[model samples]
Target chain A: LKALNGDRRRWDIAKLIYMNNISPNDCIKRWKGEDVDEDHESEIEEEEEDFFQKRNGTASNEKDAHEGDLETFKPYFETLDRLMQKWKKTDLLKDRFIGKPAFSNEDDA
Target chain B: MAPLVFQGSENFRLRLILATLAGKPIRIENIRSNALDPGLKDYHVSFLRLLEAVTNGSKMEISYTGTTVIYTPGIIIGGSHSHKCPNSKPVGYFVEPLLYLAPFSKKKFSIVFKGITASHNDAGIEAIKWGMMPIMEKFGVRECALHTLKRGSPPNGGGEVHLIVDTLLAQPITIHELERPKIMAIKGVSYSTRVSPSMVNRTIDGARKVLRNIGCEVDITADVWRGENSGNSPGWGITLVSQGQRGWCTFSEVIGDAGEVPEEIGMKAAYSLLEEISNSAVLGRPQLPLAIVFMVIGKEDIGRLRISRAQIDERFIQLLRDIKTVFGIEAFLKDVDDPDSDDFIVTIKGVGFTNTSKKIA
Candidate 1:
């Protein structure tokens, strides 16, 4: 598998899964006994950090805010991740969206 | 057991120096210390070996941990700064998203061991450059090669693309697209929920408190409003201070100056300040734009959409007029309809000639 994919863009799905943005507790609730998609998996990665920050009540930087701020910042991150996955899948599909950059184009992807 | 590796310590330093001197290219792969999963063990080593083999014949520095790498072109040079001074160019280079740098020439990239500090985290590469830019200018060297050993990790958590896109555009867009301000004013709702006069007073108080916490004068009246349906009428409407198209404009002056403010340690004062304000806004709508400016001074239920800078300027002028008229101030309304001077800051006094200070708070 390592040889199959070139060294250029090797993606560790598990690392992505562990580094997911969703929280484990949330995962326990929403994803319990269910197959998690790549997007939800990424969200869970950030959930642990969020849980700790909640327990501790303080972290040095805003980045330590567990996940992106629940209100404003998180949406952008989630949206970006969604777009990236959409892009990856789109790249795999038969017809490609033209006139847009490789990484952009979130509509109908 | 292997010697306790104090990263950037003498032993590690010696190996890098000898390797660079021996004409070997260096590679530092993903730097992680947390307990790793057995599943990722093979791929991580494979990532490092590829870098090791690629630079085997060249003189370069490679710093490798479990999953992070930093490969520089040329010998593992140190002692000197990488910053470029006024009279000189830059010597060191760093790029984000850990993309592989493919050189077009045979020029061997040099390496300098700037001890690792979680350079593997997202946004690490880009944020590091903000600190490095000023330092690099001091070194008086220009242009160096950079190749990441890891696969993906952007300096801004992959925000580089958006950053670049923003740079090309002459003007910033509404907060709607840029930062996603919660909608305070619905298109037809008589009053915006996000920021109403009631909400405005409270949120501004909140934002003021936030500013005070970070230390800054929370002066400056924030006028929020919706434009008139037809002819010019007083548009005193409440809007979320951090929402809609106008919110970004109110803060742009502040956000733009963030690079100028200094701090004892870490990034510039302005970056942190904007980050705080943005983060706070995300938590809830706190700031409101002062109404009574955009001629709809008395209208109700305007939709919240993105506004341009020009539109903001035009509206501010209208606001100033109403402020003068309603308060009976000394400044003459500089043609409230003046296509030329909106916010009619008397070109002469640079103040609203009819300045009437009020205690809205």
Candidate 2:
């Protein structure tokens, strides 16, 4: 499905739904659920150190910092997946006012 | 590297300021494409030129029809330079962006600006001086000041302003816990240029009538500029700012339009300021952009703020998206559970960015 329309001016319905469903707490919770072993723990610590050190012009390595950002953003993608499933079950685009206005008698007068 | 992309021309100033601060390239498409003129206007071009003046080696690419813009920003080298702001917009339009960029520049910054100082559409210069400068001071910008050398009105602007900022990187400051401080005093400035000096007195009288009923201690000063200090156009306006003990301030202003009486303008401005003061939120609408910028660049702790519901509009949602794109920070908005409250607490964990480009002493 197209995320943006042909003119690329407006976001498609799917994109809008995807954006509206994001939950930050849900994202953080999903990140905490990931399994962590000793090796991964050490890697996380190193990445954390590099994150601060890079800003101070001390760290030369860029690959680990890139991976750290991706790791931090992973849970947000999971939350998006959950939202898409929930949005599909609800008919958001359905027209609720299907017939004439309720005050039609006044208009006819 | 892939550049960040955005749609439409809404909030272009915020986008450009964020792009420069984050050291990222950006591309904006469909700039006024659906409008009658269908391209960048003079003010937009003027803003781009201002951006070019403050930075070194910046590259900008505009489409043939000016519908698309690609900006590659350079390091901020803030020094003394002057620019003629497009007369269509107020000088505040240009000054607001400088407030975001000045502190982190490579050198102590000073700029002399020439344009309209006050208008109905934007915040007046007095509001920026009294209301905004104090807020910036809370964020650890020590040597920032805005001086209005002359008063200018719209449509044939010749006002002059001098802005100065010390060359220093902003230290991360926490504004997480906000308490509704006691209103110390309601202060204001009623200014008139190229008009009868009596207009200033009338404006003060009218504003005092409304503010007196509020039961707050109101002290409003009248400024009547004459001779060379007055600009090419004739105008009168009032700026009302409420100062709080906790370093919070809210401002409201009204500029005189054609056939509008001075007292009417004064009453309108006073009522607007009263409405802002009545709100329970800690910050005002004008201060939201500055708060968001600080949140994105501050130290890596959750920065929290309580803002009124009216501040949470489409522009704010766009700001959230821009923050995420440029700085990789996610802003979370949650409603205050009190049924009678009309405020929301916004929280963001900063990206822990430091100004690494500043030359070491």
Candidate 3:
């Protein structure tokens, strides 16, 4: 716990706490010393920068980094949504276009 | 068969594996086109070589700058072979696709792979052993084995693993329903090579601290390798698998770093396993690609699966497009309506592909 508290500035440690069931309030109380508001906020700010840089490879600021990450994945989400819409439309049209033959050649023969 | 063309180097493994299975040629262009050091890397070349080793009559053409490659796939003639993987990537990167292709090979496939066994990026060998093999069995392919002969770490790798699989011509599988199985126990392997033997114990102790409250029996074994079994590098890592009923297992792992403590690795791995278990998905993250492959090529009927959105990435979307283009199998994904639900139900009907030619049957 001491080690984690000492290295609480690291982004991975923050991630670890976030992933586990520990609440942010408890984490702040245990890891960050009381009455050190500036230090605690700075540490979180630095961790956010590190997280964004690691996530999308470019991070000028936290907001820009987050937007960039979203931009990187926006095309994929759009493509998936478009594909799903097309498939749904195709399913609606399948019965009319792909129904059984009205007159079988064997019956005609 | 007409050649399938695509841009970019993403989904390279999936494209090649599907091409081999479909008996079609593929032309990939603009590989890393915008990157500073664009084109195929040494690791990509090594993967291509491994593919060539498993197939017969395969032909490849590469541009001088390595920006373009045209691959004509050949018959999958599976037999004993070996390849040295590049140090840049872990063996898991290559092993995952091999798991998809091995069962359909013409002969009983046995391959010895040498490279990094565990790393931060790719799925570790232990994950595949516990998580993927059982899923493959559900698809009716049996007698698959992955054995670690030497433990290796990243940067300078010398690990060795032996893989064996029995081929099947055509096997139809039906999995209409997936029930969330109750986790019976949690098992793990904490290993170190050329490192302090106490590292294993530290990892196990740290993992147990987090895992004991999960209401399941937990057992983690430790192994310290030396001499021939230990690779050149000095490193340690932990692989944790949560075993559930109905052949369901979730895997998580963490590789040690220069300044990281064993306890951190163990705790991180345990938390990752817990996250996976809590995520309401039928297929584990690593098993998502394999399940999609089976759904595309299995018997012609509706196949349904509910997977977490975390498993759906750009590579998975590209794979769906490729399957649609090559095999004419359409896949649909619909998000569940629950506000707290993170599941996407995917449905697809297979193309009923069957292999008619067998070298020995």
The residue-by-residue lDDT of candidate 1 on A7-92, one tens digit each, is: 23233222222322433233322322223233444657457545654666333334334232211111111222332333333233
| Per-residue accuracy of model 3 over A1-109 as CA lDDT, tens digit each | 1233223433322232332233333343333332233345466855764564476632234434332221121111112233233333222222212123332331211
**lDDT for each residue of candidate 3 in B339-358, tens digit (9 for 90 to 100):** 45555668878877675446
How high is each candidate's TM-score?
Answer: 0.21, 0.76, 0.75
Q: Assess the local accuracy of residue B113 in candidate 2 as a C-alpha lDDT between 0 and 100.
A: 90
- Model 2: share of real contacts kept: 0.00
The order of the candidates by lDDT, greatest first, is: 3, 2, 1
Clashes of 3: 0
Candidate 3's C-alpha runs over 4 A off are: A1-109, B167-169, B334-342, B359-361
Q: Write the per-residue lDDT of candidate 2 for residues B1-361, one digit (tens) a residue.
A: 6789977786788889899988899999998899899988898899999999999878999999998999999988889999888888888888877888888888878999999998765657887788777777777786888889988987787899998988477445766844445566678999988989889889889788765534346789999988888899999899888877667787887788768788877777776665555443676666777878887798888888877655553345556767777887777766565555555677878877677558762
* Candidate 2: CAPRI quality band: incorrect
Local distance difference test, per candidate?
0.24, 0.70, 0.70
Off by over 4 Å in 2: A1-109, B337-340
Per-residue CA lDDT of model 1 for B253-361, tens digit only, reads: 1110112211111111122223323333212111111111211111222212222222222112322332332323222212223332222111111112110111121
Q: How many residue pairs clash in each candidate?
A: 79, 0, 0
Error of 2 at B359 (Å): 1.7
> How well does candidate 1 match the true structure in TM-score terms?
0.21
Task: List model 2 lDDT by residue over A21-83, tens digit each.
Answer: 332222222223322222343657557644555665423234333323211110111122333
